[model samples]
Target: MIWHSTGRSEDGVMCHPVDGESWQKFDVDYPNFSSEPRNIRLGLAGDGFNPFGNMCNPHSTWSVVLTTYNLPPWLCMKESSFMLALLIPGPKAPGKDIDVFLRPLVEELKFLWQSGIRIKDTATNTFFMMKAMLLWTINDFPARSSLSGWSGQGYRACPTCNEDTPSYRAVNKVVYIGHRRFLDADDPLRMSFKFNGQPETRPTPRHFTNEDIQEQLGRLILRKPGKHPNTLKENMDRQGFELNRSKRSIFFELEYWSSLQLKHNIDLMHVEKNVGESLLGTSMMNDKSKDTSKAREDLKNLNIRRNQWLQKRVYQIEKENSPEFHKELSALSMGSQMDVYTYTACIINGVRFMVLSRDAQRKTQNSGVLTVCENGEKYYGQLEEIMEVQYPYDYSTVIFRCKWFDTGDIPDDNFISIDTEKEAYQDDQLIYASQAKQVFYIREPVNHRRNQNNNPRCVVEHVNHQNIWDLPSDNARVQNAYSDSVQDVDNVEVENVDIVQKDSSPGARLFIEFSHTFKAMLT
Candidate 1:
């Protein structure tokens, strides 16, 4: 069961003992052991006692050759177990290297297997149970002791040292400690700490400087545009809303105009034509009135007259005193006042005409003619006399006049004027008629008693002679019509007249006569 080295022989083979027997030149093979057998030869000699004689008497020498066998499994297993125990947990053995420890453990495992000891049975029955118990003690003891301080509170073990502590406080402490250590190692000015917590010198972390914090905060506050994918569509939609409002205004204006047209039933084309004609006429009148030669002559004549009157008045007033004259003159002098002139024109049918005029000097003649063409008929009058000027400056005006005549009587004239100036002119020409043929004088006032309360009454002068004709049923008539017929045509032939004959009875005769009279009056 034991292995002992005997000696090395001249043949250069190692001799060892096994099973308490000496082996020499023996073929020894052990599984997981030596691969070759070592051999040794022993010599013995016997001789008769020939005292002090290197005598010629000789004795025979004997060579003993022995064979050895492998040790038993039980014996080898026990030896291996003892070796493993000594290698693993024993004190440092003399003359043993790292290989010696490892090799013994390996040999023990192999011997245990050869002795029919299963590795799982040995681990569970003995070695593993003991190791597990030892590990449990080492892991649980510190954890149990630290529990009193950590009672009723959550705790996290330190990642580096595996010691129980409050998580955030532990992290902060470690960070500061690590920072201090790192600084002390690099900086000669900073004194390193011993077991005490106080620092002998100040230490700072360059990486955790104020500049780095500021840079990081600046990046957080000022973000790049379009970086967040989720916000891109929302931003785009907001921009689109702004764009749509501008585009929608045009559609709104169009709708407003259409509604206005529908409510007023205005013929836009007719309105435009009338406006153009009136503008043209006004321009013509302006050109004609701009003849400075006539205005200059009138101004000259007035100035001469005024100067003469002033000179005469001055001479008479001189009797009072020169001072009196000066005082009176100075009192009479007034500062210059700003004056403005505005002219407005409107078109009627194909003709252009002026509808309004405001002059600063109050000297400009207001008796300008306005010509209106309606339904292929021409009429002329002063705008001031015929229609009221509403907002003359804005050119918004209206004229109320009758559309048809019931009788031959002259209509009443209503005067409406908007005097915006500070001083009113009594001598201002109220109305003027151009193309005298189209002008008609109203000799009698119009009657409004029939529909006075119900209908709006307006007085319109007849611009056409044919419009003056009245039906026989109307009793009132102008008596001196022939005197004003100087411009009337004689024996004028008229078309579109119809005559009806009646029965020659008394009542029928009366009706026939009445009918004839009515026709004549209408004509």
Candidate 2:
């Protein structure tokens, strides 16, 4: 592990925290402190777990652990290297009250940073003042808020984006977007019409400096320790909205805390797990997925992703393809005397759909449809109408009428090009609502446009829907998403972007025993 101090492994891989910018910045700022590799550089990690493993009857037991980055990367994260600094027992998590329990540790850290303890170096047979600095805190997003005094929810939830976090109040939940702004300045995606129609020329949000954060803290009234912060509404007051800080974190008491380039780290495990679950739920189109009917509606409200809308449609198949499909039409079989009701919108398989007319009225085109044939062929169309037909026993089934765009050619290159000028299935245009999956279309950019007409040929994008496939368990889906993110980071896959691991560990035992006062306060 001593070789790790050289900053690069034998294979040229950066295998230690010593090679990172954060650690380098720390050294440049406090050269004296970093002069000795033996001088302790520590990280504090805290997380709550269910000891019982029974989620139904859960207990919040939090472990605060400290690790040193002085060791080589491989040995640093081993369980044996973990030093259990404090165990917070809880029938409930401490929340903001966690500061009360953390007071003893903060005081010790302050003492170590201010005045040093004398210790003999075993290898050199020389005595020196041993001192330590807490480089950063490590925790999941929720625990980070508790430890860092930053709220992890609402509009400014993302610490990196801060005030510039792009948020949309969806029909159901608040969602964050605008990752495209992080792209390169000349990236084509910045000017692409696929997302939200308008070009995203907004430069990346300004990174908050240490001075910026300190200025915010100067104006904030730190909340009392052990008391919960205000509700989201109350916190939206002028001061709270301006400065998202809930309290001045106890860590800021350390003299060197503000100078460190990175003050807190979001644990990769939690972030990856969350991102993975979101991907699986979406791919499987299940209830656990964030891509719900409300999500589609959110797209509509934002005037983006217009193709994702499930349109009210008349089901009509091409007579040449499904020749008998016209005979199955309820419209032809049932006379006008039969009661048929029309609806603008309906929910099917957790996917929300709107009629083409309704889609036009709303100015969001969601009426696209994609259907797969038994022979593996695919058809693309736009829904025209939605109808509910009454049966002899008063049973009812909804049907859709659609106008399918004509596919010009099955290209040798395997590209699908649809001609909006030509309609495909004219005579045979009817399908049971259950048989349809929503789809949307995007035209090739002007330079790449494959058609000559004003209405260019379009490409189809499937609207992710529920019940598409039998999905893996929650844990497995998360693992897949997490693994995918790690493997494909160079591709800029955003679903659940992985955070680079910054903290390292090695063997250590340094406990901050709780004082009687702290124990009494816990009780």
Candidate 3:
């Protein structure tokens, strides 16, 4: 385990947390602590969840977990290795009071960092004083504010950007903008008029350093725990919006906190979920979308995107006033239209089937197959066209025209292999759409790839069509059928038993009869 933790992979890929630069930096800074590989490196994570499973209860529970990064990457993340350091039960999240609950854990970590603990190394059969470090804290956005004592909201909400965070009021919410500032100076988007109708000539915001953060945090008044959130807002407004630091984070109490490269890491899962939901909602223009009527109004107020204003644009539609439009509307209302509808695809028995013309254009074919069972004989074919015949009383029925494969020379095998180039039953082309079943054809691999015409045989595979809202039946029929020449082996075995018993001696005949009876019972 020690070798695995300290070694690199064959291709030099990072396979464990020890390979990270932060670990190396810590090791270089604290040579005495890095001397023993057995010393554990831990990460702290906390989140609030509902224990009752009923959201209406409004009760919340926060679990503080510690992960040991000394083990192999595969084993380190497993639940078995996780240490539940603390569980804070509540009718509401602890918020700023979380530091009060974290005090004991912080003191223990400080003791481990200074005095250390003596333990027996099971692998080495020796005792050594082991020390550990609190590498970082992981939490979602809201929990980050509680854990780090930093405001995750307001004009200067971003911790990395500090006072230079870009934001503006858009209708009812704060909209963060100026992402183009991070792009290359020569990039076309820097001069694009589509966004805010102005070029983004501003440079990217500067990242805040640890000393700068400490200086800014020292000037702020720490709000007492359990106070109304509005009170914190009032205090911040009084102090001014230039600073987002609420208080010195409780983590700073640790001796090595300032020395660590990253003290707080935002959980990626929550960020991904939020970004994905916003993208999908906006693209689909659903109720969850941010692109609302008021948003367009705001854009118009900004004197940008004149074409996308809420005002309707007039379009010329000469057909709407044409005489033919009234005639078509009357026919549709009366259900007396004489026109026949030709469709490229249709669904039958919960299976989608498409005509050959439409299916040919696709890379993967799903609807071209046509299979039918008539007079106890199964026929394989490809769909040619789908037509709907309408009657005067709004009655209609669908018909399918297909081209069938030749079955006369098909080999006697378990799989139905047919010559793709040959056609059979040409005169018998049309069938009621209800009789058709969906299927697909797979061409057999051959040595001559460049000459597909030389390898014309294709194996038939049937598709199972089932209702969406129904459970699958235990006794579903198998689709594969055996050729007529391959007789049932069970019947052949029974005939052999009859022939053997007739020529056997009396004792042998009695044994044969008993065996036959046993076989029949087993069947």
Which model scores highest in lDDT? 3
- What's the C-alpha lDDT at position 272 in model 1? 73
- Tens-place lDDT per residue, model 2, 1-523, is 2333564655755667677788889889888877766678888999899899999986899999998777767667878887898999988998867888899999998888778789888888988888888989999889999998888888788888877788867786677778899999999778765566557899988988989888877887644554355645454344754555677788888888888888889999888989999999888869777776777777767665443432211123432454545322433323222345555554445455676766767656667877778886777888887655543323345566788877755553545667677888786677766667888777756655444335566766655665332222553212121121112333443332212110111211111111111111111
Candidates 1 and 2, the one with greater TM-score: 2
Against the true structure, what is each candidate's TM-score? 0.13, 0.58, 0.56
Please identify model 1 stretches exceeding 4 Å from their true place.
Answer: 1-224, 227-234, 239-370, 373-382, 385-438, 441-523
> What number of backbone clashes does candidate 2 have, counting pairs of residues 3 or more apart or in separate chains?
23
Off by more than 4 A, model 2: 1-4, 7-12, 228-238, 309-523
Candidate 3 at 159: error in angstroms? 0.7
Sort the predicted structures by lDDT, highest score first.
3, 2, 1
- Local accuracy of candidate 3 as per-residue lDDT tens digits, 47-164: 9999999988899899999998877778878999899999999889998789889999999999999989999988879998888889988999899989887788887777667788
What tens-digit string does per-residue lDDT give for candidate 1 at 7-116?
Answer: 23346544322322223212132222232221111111111133335446443221111112233334422424321122122122111122233344335333432342
Ten consecutive residues with minimal summed lDDT in candidate 1?
A: 130-139
lDDT of 2 at 291: 71
Positional deviation of residue 168's Cα in model 1 after best superposition, in angstroms: 64
Residues forming the 10-long window of minimal summed lDDT in candidate 3: 511-520
Question: Candidates sorted by TM-score, descending order?
Answer: 2, 3, 1
Angstrom error of the Cα, residue 426, model 3: value is 78
Error of 2 at 84 (Å): 0.6
In angstroms, how far off is 343's CA in candidate 2? 40
